[model samples]
Target: MRFIKLFCLLISCSFISPQISAQGNKNISATEKKILDQGLVDIQSVNPEILVELKYATPDNFMKKNVYGDLTHAYLQPEIAKRLSKASSLLKKAKPGYKLLVYDAARPNTAQYKLWDALDDLKIPARQKTQYVADPKIGSNHNFGCAIDLTVVDEKGNPLDMGTKYDFFGPLAYPRSEQEMLRQGKLTTKQIANRNILRMAMVHAGFTVNTTEWWHFDGMSKKQARAKYGMIK
Candidate 1:
């Protein structure tokens, strides 16, 4: 009877191990993985001072689901990673006690379809949704590993209040609308200043800020980005 129980346990373990391994590799396609291997680098390796929190890898994002499955690493194109490292160094030099906290980077093109489908269920107009998330056909700089969503944090890793959350899809999240938001009391002066500090560092390090999202920054112009990098599908 004991031998029979042991045999059953071993069978269960054998089946479970394969399932777990498959789950680990299922989120990213083979082609995507190969691109990542050849063209991207973990941002942490470029700047150990930067803090990485891959929101899409967990259920804490706007999707409210684990879109990145088991992959939690924040990766970027090699040049982008170097620029991010420079940005981190600039911020630290300027503040001496702050660091950049990254939220998302190097999103797969396949994942863009999931976000697009989820947005379709909402009452938002297609144009409005596109402002926040690019249509998969057009593709985002993130899909090319040339964009990043991030904020500033203090020495202790406490995030600076940027008036809105990372994925906030409203006018309040707009860097261009900060004055209007401030006038409406939706955002404070200090929050705008904090946002500017982050922008200054990234801009000086060769990144362009998006008009709609204060947290979103592109390593290059959209035209240059798409032309230079292949979309990660």
Candidate 2:
């Protein structure tokens, strides 16, 4: 009887070990693991109020394919994460029930290559593509975990209309063109106001706005990021 009980316990242990290993591996991708290993903190860990919907983790992005498999959480460098948390707090204070919704953060260089290739396959002109997607060779602030793509969401979790959708590659999405677009009736005043709310919170938290992409913000300049931390491989 004692031998039989021991055998049963061994069998259960063997099954449980593999299950645990598989669950841990499926929780995040290798690229994400590397990002975490490099000391990037998951944004939600710093501020649970900030919502995350990583576009690359789903097919809803401009790529139209899920590039970040099993990697749903948004990560950023420690200081950048703190700034984002501050931005989240600012939004809540300013708008009562609004929240900062993150779309992407701490992208790996490997993912950058995927985006670059996707643009090439789309036959986008070199100059036009660079405006939307950074050349992987040069690296983006995202590669160093200093950039984020985000928007504002109301109390009920609905994202505010920011003129164009996230990742829209056109003049309509350009911050510099917002006034012109509003004057031309392409963007409404309410939409511009919604964008300003998000901009104010982020800027107040010490983030630099990306002029061409309203949803994108950098915690620091590319040169600063490179000097502090090299691109995440």
Highest-lDDT candidate:
2
| Total backbone collisions for each predicted model | 0, 0
Instruction: Flag regions of model 2 displaced more than 4 Å.
Output: 1-29
lDDT of each: 0.85, 0.89
> What is the lDDT, from 0 to 100, of the residue 89 in candidate 1?
90
Residue 94 accuracy (lDDT) in model 2: 94
**Residue by residue across 1-233, what tens digits does model 2's lDDT show?**
99999999998777753322533434656766777778788888778888999999999988899987767788899999999999998988899999999999988888899999999777889888889999899999999999999999999999999988998978999999999998899999999999999999999999998999999999998999999997898
Q: What is the C-alpha RMSD of each candidate to the true structure, in Å?
A: 8.0, 5.1
Clash pairs (backbone) in predicted model 2 = none
Worst 10 residues of 2 by lDDT: 17-26
